[model samples]
Target chain A: MNEFLEQFLVEARELVEQATADLLALEREPDDRASLDGSFRAFHTLKGGAGIVDFAAMAHAMHAAEDVLSTVRKGDRPVTPDMIGECLTCLDQVVQWLDAIEDSGELPGEADAEADLLAARFAARAAASEGAKANSPVLGTAPSSATALAVLQEQIALLAVRGEGLEGRIASAGRLAANIFRHLGRFDDAERIAGSVSESLAGLDTTSIARSIESALERLADKLSPSQIAPVAVRPDPLSRTLRINAERVEALVSLTGELTVANNAIGHIAMLAQEGDNPLAAGIADEHRKLDRLIAGLQRAVLELRVLPMRGVFQRFSRLVREMSESLTKPVRLTIEGEDTHADKAIIEMLSDPLLHVVRNAMDHGVETCAERASAGKPAIATIHLRARREGEHVVVEVEDDGRGIDPNRIRKTVVERNLAAADAVAGMSDEALVDLIFMPGLSTATDVTDLSGRGVGMDAVRASVERLGGRVQLETRLGSGSTVRFLLPFSVMMTEVMTVEAGGQLFGIPLDAVVETVRIPREEIRSVGHAHAFVLRNRTIPLLGLGQTLGWAKVESDSDATVVVASTGGLLGGLEVDKLGSRMDVMLKPLEGILSGIPEIAGTTVLGDGGVLLVLDVKELLR
Target chain B: MALTILVVDDSKLARMAVAKVLGGLCPDWTRVEAANADEALAAMHEKTPDLAVLDFNMPGRDGLDVAAQIRGLRPSMPMAVISANHQKEIVDRAHALGAVFLSKPLTEPALRDFLAGAVRQIEAGAA
Candidate 1:
């Protein structure tokens, strides 16, 4: 099951308990920095881990507790009974969710309520203790006004505290303002403000005179980008346990692995050439080739292993969403994620996120029954949604399943006919399974009414189309009373793309392996022209064809007696691209279009060939769109 | 009825400007002006406002004297001390008395930020 979650729960339990004890100790001895730091680290760790596992409510509660302890650490607010109580409550809430996660691979249903209650309490305590002296704002990170704002605020509070050098500082502050205005060519206003400051120095009390100086200084600092204001370092370390690495670094590793594989192939080619020479070095070359080949293979595997991430990251994000959806709909729901340790390529895991989220959304919004309905149907009052992932040979299957009232096949049949999605006779001949599967059809939602969660009718079909675009397949399964499961079958890794090379418009282009249905050489005369586009019959259906040179904005040249067409499909749409010829299919590590070229969607990504030239991969989905 | 904010500064011009600002931006807020600690304390007892803003250095009994006395009277009253002397210990003392602080000649943005924060505290106290 979720072994990773099991480890997280065990460590989290200890951290939560440790934090609870530290908070109690801090209550007894408010100035105990050791205990304060202990609690801060514990909650911070707990919050980070909880976020990783998708225990949102727990993460949220820990976050608030962390904030409270931060104030204590900063010496801004002394440990109060209310703060201690709030911290303990926050700890208790996280522990409760941890227990639920341990027992079931899901958080408890009341998590949101607990988070809200604890957040409100923390906010109330923070509000009550208003000396909210945060780190003198990070001037370097903030706008120019931030430093001025901090200085202005500090000086305002300092007015009454001034004993010595009060007049000199005020005079200097006035002169600073006058100097600024003088440089800006507002000499009259400058003189007026400066004269007022010098005169007010004796006319008003110390507080009022200081106020006048503060106003003049504020006007000076307003336009001046003088980075003179100093900010105090008010942190106990926001990062301690974790080391964050850049994404570019990880991608560079992947790119190097690609080059390593290419170099390894060159060694094999040399070994073959040596064998033909019939020399003593031939045997050595062959032996070295075998050893190098194995080493390169292992190196490539290790590199790919770095990019493989378990499902926990994506699955953890869903629990909070389910909690939010349940709270929003006033429907109690539980989310269970299994096989969280089942690792997939990081890119593949991220690409699978949107489709899986939509499926989970649909499961909670429409698949689950209300408490009253569930009670009447002799089921648990709290609806359950199970998110399962497992490796099935070549593909990893992720399923979002919910046991509630399932889709009615008869309703689908009716909607199919009503929406003109299918002919009346065609729908009449469909079986229950086939009819239920029609929910995957675009613009054919079975929900009686639209709600915030679902029933937009664009939900399931979009999931299907995206999954298909990622070279994966989405399937729907249901029984009338047994609920439904939306399953997405994805590849093990998306780091390396298997693309079929095609020569188009005298330049080379790469078509993703999944997008290519077949490359057929059709007779030139058989290509019929229809509305400025060529077409040809495939089976009984007419498929539209376009010249690759024309599509790429190159001048169209007259074709030969025969044409080589690349059959491409994106979701349900089918099309043909007539190219000069097809080349050898190769595996490539694609770096998606970045920088200025990133927004241009037609070119999906680029990859390096053995000779180091870049090959552009075509995104058929955007191409058709 | 409009909420009230007491503003105590020794200078008449300073107090009048604050009153004008209260009337302009926060029209509903009634400004209870005071020239010193005694007047501020007297104004507070007569009709306590939702918030208190006092100048730190006043004649006779200073602003901190007024805050200390007010804390003794209404321990949890939302109070602020405006000063130009940014001595760490002095600001710390004001903070120790459970009073927030502001710089002199409060600008519009700073005033707005402080009010938003203080209002939350007031609402939380009420809750």
Candidate 2:
């Protein structure tokens, strides 16, 4: 039961995210059946998950939304901007409930009341949509009598306009009056009305007949109901739409696969030992072990693939925040998302959410100017903020760029000095790049005045912290007049990484393969030293080399005539770490350093090599800095 | 052998909820779980459950469709459709299929009632 609750919470949050995204997407293409189905499915899943956990109030609230979505799916109601807003509100309520549940393992005291209020609102909206129902529209409990009377009124109007088609028009009008009277249980009145119309027809008097029909129509109008009864479209798509599984299960699968890969590597080592003896049976075992290694590697890859998820959910959320922020700031800003289909580890994407949101919000609030200000600056009234994510080798680079007033480095420098963030003389000598980096320093804001939109002092500092937590770094680029772009380069997955094992000082250290450009042998004869920093020329570019043994606090080892350098780069900072040996490359699932070593700058994580040796994966960027 | 019950819902949580009630009411009963209609039908194929609890609003096939399939083969099987939908149409359909329509959240009282109904049906079937 506990496991189920845990799983439910995970699935519920995902569905809420999905539903919110689909509703916002529907704002773009209201006629999109796919989004409609997607929304309905999400609500359905949310309600179902809630039900399983016996969270009746939450389930009931989602049911109301699901019903509204059902009506939209069946075309009984048109998808309006208001409806989308309502759906988003409903999702917001779900988010609140999920948060409360996560905190207390149960709902808040007012959950039922809140659920009822939201359900009532959704139901009221559903009823309003029914008012605009296409067929058999009724004014209010307005009986079939009202419909007949409406028809009679139309017929009489036609006759009055044509002035000559009175015979057919009067005959149809008389028939409607009779049926309405009969429906009202007034048989005598029906006959009397019919007789009066016929008598007027005999006198060939159109005016008299039309007058009687009008009086009868008035009587029927009093009984009208204020709604229409329209048939819902039958969407009989009986197929398995989607399946939600516990993410923990997938995580477990990945862990097992990692273990198998290590085990397989050990098997290879054993097989090599057997083949060294040159016995026929041992060689056969070695050949079979080779085939097993390939299979295990494939299985490992397949398992890890389960953790990859598209960035659509995370990216879609920004548009909503952008919309709300722009309206509140009265800034006419537009957001464009590119490469939303790019995929990354679910954990990486999760950690990226708030940081991404902060960047986007900061872009709209600070980077983009108001219409009046933009117009004066000769820029378009509506500013554009573009968010793009694309795979770059083993990393996913997400950039939020805006066409607003760029961050002024001069102001940042001034603020740095005024706020005493740094010594005045030191800040004055700082480069523009270094000054810009000061914005991310917590407790400081470059904004001159505090506004609700931003300027809360918690600026890029939080974003940088989050990105760094995910084994990623933040890059900021700004021009004085043009705009500012904040880019985050993160690994494809934070859970597992491929590292190149290198031996230094008789200890093994792993370097993320993505950060290593190449390994080269630079002769010591060409090495130069400037103020205790080692430098060497490699392919026309001067690269600095730091021996791993020297960096890790071991006795400084002097390089021989030819030295091995593992060239590494992070966030554009490059350096070479000379190690004694470069070992075999393998995949290792990482656990963040804990206990006393949690915040160690040099050690990113620790992993066990196949031979039971613990290897510390070096934080290449940190080491270079 | 203990009577087997198949619980189908898109939510693992909801499936667990029903399993809890079933476990409480019929301690000896076996409970099989499926996350969607396809798995539900697949479970039915393996071994017909004496009782089936389904949730509506799945992606592909919903509760009603799954119920209809079961109605064809196990016409006397006592089933309950647990959904968040409170529409009259859903209740009517459940009645037509001789199944009980239970609103979602599937709270303690609701599940207890469902169990009672299932237990009665199970005894009648055995007789």
- Give the DockQ (C-alpha) for candidate 1: 0.01
Error of 1 at A194 (Å): 51
Which parts of model 2 have CA positions greater than 4 angstroms off? A1-248, A268-290, A308-343, A378-397, A407-446, A449-469, A473-483, A506-508, A539-541, A556-560, A581-584, A590-600, B1-127
* Model 2 / residue A258 / CA error / Å: 2.9
lDDT string, candidate 1, A27-73, tens digits: 89988887888788777667655654556777777778778887788
Tell me the DockQ of each model, to 2 decimals: 0.01, 0.48
Compose the digit string of candidate 2's lDDT tens values, residues A1-625. Answer: 2677667767777777777778878989998877888898898878767766667888778878888888778778888987887777777667656656654566555566456556645655665466732233245432223334444555566557656766776776676556555544445656767887787778767676677766665654532221121211111112221555557899889888878777776777677777787766787878898799779867876776688776765776576566556656767666777877688988887778889988887887778877778889998666878888999987899999999899888988888788888898998888888888888888888776678766677968889878977878899999876799999999887766779999998888999987899998878888889788988888889888898988888897665668889999875678988889988787777767988988789998988766666779998978998
Best by TM-score: 2
RMSD of each: 23.4, 16.3
Q: lDDT (CA) for every model shown?
A: 0.71, 0.75
Instruction: Please list the residue runs of candidate 1 whose C-alpha ends up more than 4 Å from where it truly belongs after superposition.
Output: A1-252, A261-297, A317-324, A327-334, A348-354, A371-382, A408-444, A461-471, A525-532, A537-543, A595-600, B1-127
Worst 10 residues of 1 chain A by lDDT: A230-239
